[model samples]
Target: MNYFQPKPISNFNATIDIPGSKSITNRALILSALSGKTITLKNILLSDDTQYMIKALRSLGNKIEYNESSKILKIIGNKNPKYDNIDLYIGNAGTAMRFLSSYLATGTGTATLHGNSRMNERPIKDLADSLTQLGVKVEYLNKFGYPPIRITSSGVWATSVKIDGSKSSQYISSILMAAPNFKNPIDISFIGKVVSKPYIHMTLTMMKDFGASFTLKENSINIVPKEYNLSEYLIEGDMSSASYFLAMSLISNSTITLNNFFKNSIQGDSKFLDVLLKMGLTILDFKEYSITVKGTSSYKGIQLSMNDIPDVAQTLAAVALFATTPTKVWDVENMRIKETDRISALKNEISKINGDFIEFKDGFLINPKPLEMYQGDFLETYDDHRMAMSLSLIGLKVPNIKVLDPSCVSKTFPNFFEEFNKIYRED
Candidate 1:
């Protein structure tokens, strides 16, 4: 295993420029492809997930040009697509799998969507069933209700459809983005509680940005069928990536600034700032597109429900190891089905550092204390990018910590370690 050890140091301070959000980039690609016009995306993230999305879109006959030097993606939308009966492999990109499944189901011709082994295991039934309700034929190839499935395109016909949103919000977003292509106005009703409601709103807002209008009434959303307006869209820096720096600031008693922070952001992970503020970290300044955070000598801990912003749960778990009080995280059962079983991975890795933790079905409670000894010398990341990055924070306070598969961070932040080292003050 190729592992990289993050060297611990004092006086950590720097300005971080996080890349564009994976969620936003993938969603923008789908909306732009649907608009059938030239839409340019600025500051787009170039990572494993976004690459899969771009590859899948290109295979569907959409013209996409990406300039690596300028960090811009120019997409020529295909309002009417003539896709070959090609099999697309998305490699664990949930957004591309879900969004493209719906997007291709509306156009003519057959396209089979598959991915890496893990992606093949991930649930697609909710989105599949929802697409089926809209008159799209979704046939499972390997297993029922999972990917490696086939979608035979005809056209959506249902005026009203119901979907279960408890598992993933991408199901709702996928359907919402494809609704405009239907001949008639579409009404979508959710059967259960919507997890990550902000992402659903993000999808609706982006759809509106592309000239698709929607009205919400109770548990359902009504989308008007109209042509989308093609225009340039600028993606904001990922707030999920910012959580690590926020936690680092408090842990090291250093100040850090994140450029392109976007105070008025659509990302649910932006709520992470509230969690840090409650823990007694001082927000030195909140600028329009950036924020400065100054750390304190110590910090307190509290219980937090991370249902809306579960992506930051691992960052909070790592920070909890240094908290003055026990930090409890709740309403994150969905974390079990991420890139890896995060709950179990956290338990296994934290135990090695002598951190006290109690696991629950949906969440965990961590009690901070001094390190006794390491049961293991190296930390296992389970090939999850967030796990690798979050657990690396422990090396800042604890010694002899090396993370396996550090390059797994290419899933989101490709230059995480390089950029993190920029802030490390060696004296």
Candidate 2:
């Protein structure tokens, strides 16, 4: 259970094929399930978060046949959805909880959407309140704005909603995904800043691809409900998942291949490549959907504002260690509400290495110029998968860097350490 130990290695170099994207995988799962058609999903991630979704879907009466040989997942649409009195446990995936909140609210039966301890702690009232405005009765089982929500779906509830977009895109995407049932499409207007705009775009694009109709302008999206013709949906590899390895080229100075990446991916995190590029990493396009990353012989610091793709903050923090100058990331407040308080966690742990970091109003600035190796110490992962995996990069170049709860990577990458060792082993 304690995977903590100092690992020291020199000259990290290897080509790695990262796992499927969690964001893309979850979207495909929900879309396939809703379309009531079998979707032959490719490169589905087999992490705990995804497995939790798969298991929950199976309980909801979806038959998923996974072919390990080719990494294809065949999700047999529910010929008869087993809503026969069951609670869908989403664990800690906010995406699962929010999207499903809007999704299951249209079901005929009463359903409960809930998760782990952290789930109840995380806010969902914004999403729940929006559902309620549309006649979807979402009652909080305990604390308001949190989970353990009770939803009793009647029919297609079409009511336009206006909400603050600065909160989270999952709220808006929730409305869009569940709007297909209304005789009148859901009309949503944003009241404040829209964070994670790319993800909202992704939802619209996916819905459009699946035959649903929608229009997005500025902060408003008009979704016209139509019967989506179910077909096989194959998702490209997750760029977020690939970011670690792509970043490895910079941190480890290795060549890594991230296969099946989409040039036009619905995943907002795909911008990670561009971010790394700004940091001086280059990609050699191998095939149409695959590329190899060759790091620049030298490193340069990049000061970026990560409001759009905030999830990569941890990786960027890790990447900062190799930069010639200090890297300052700003306006990433959303990182605080993720699996853990990421901003604080990043600062707390990074300080242990060299104690050379500063926290800004919304983000952190890492000064790796003073980074120095220390005695062997186990870095606690705080049950956050990103924190665990991101810390591993530091160990590649620094001695006595141990990672605790390395298994926490299963939240996204189940075989992270194994693959890490594989990509890092000396020839």
Instruction: Name the top TM-score candidate.
Output: 1
TM-score of each: 0.97, 0.93
Cα lDDT tens digits for candidate 2, 286-312? 566788777765688789889999888
- List where candidate 1 sits over 4 angstroms from the true fold: 371-376, 425-427
Kindly list the per-residue Cα lDDT of model 1 for residues 1-427, writing each as its tens digit: 6887876654666888878898999999999998999999998999999999998888888899999998999999887576767899999888888999888867888889998888887898988898888888889999999989998887777799999988889999998998898878988999887888889988888888888888989999998788889679999889998889888888777888888799999898998988988887789899889998988777887897888988899999988888788999988888887888898899999988888878998899999986444333589987799999999888877877889999999999999988788776422
Global Cα RMSD, each model? 1.4, 2.2
RMSD (CA, Å), candidate 1 to true, equals: 1.4
How high is the CA lDDT of each candidate model?
A: 0.86, 0.76
Q: Roughly what TM-score does model 2 have, to 2 decimal places?
A: 0.93
The residue pairs in collision within model 1 are none
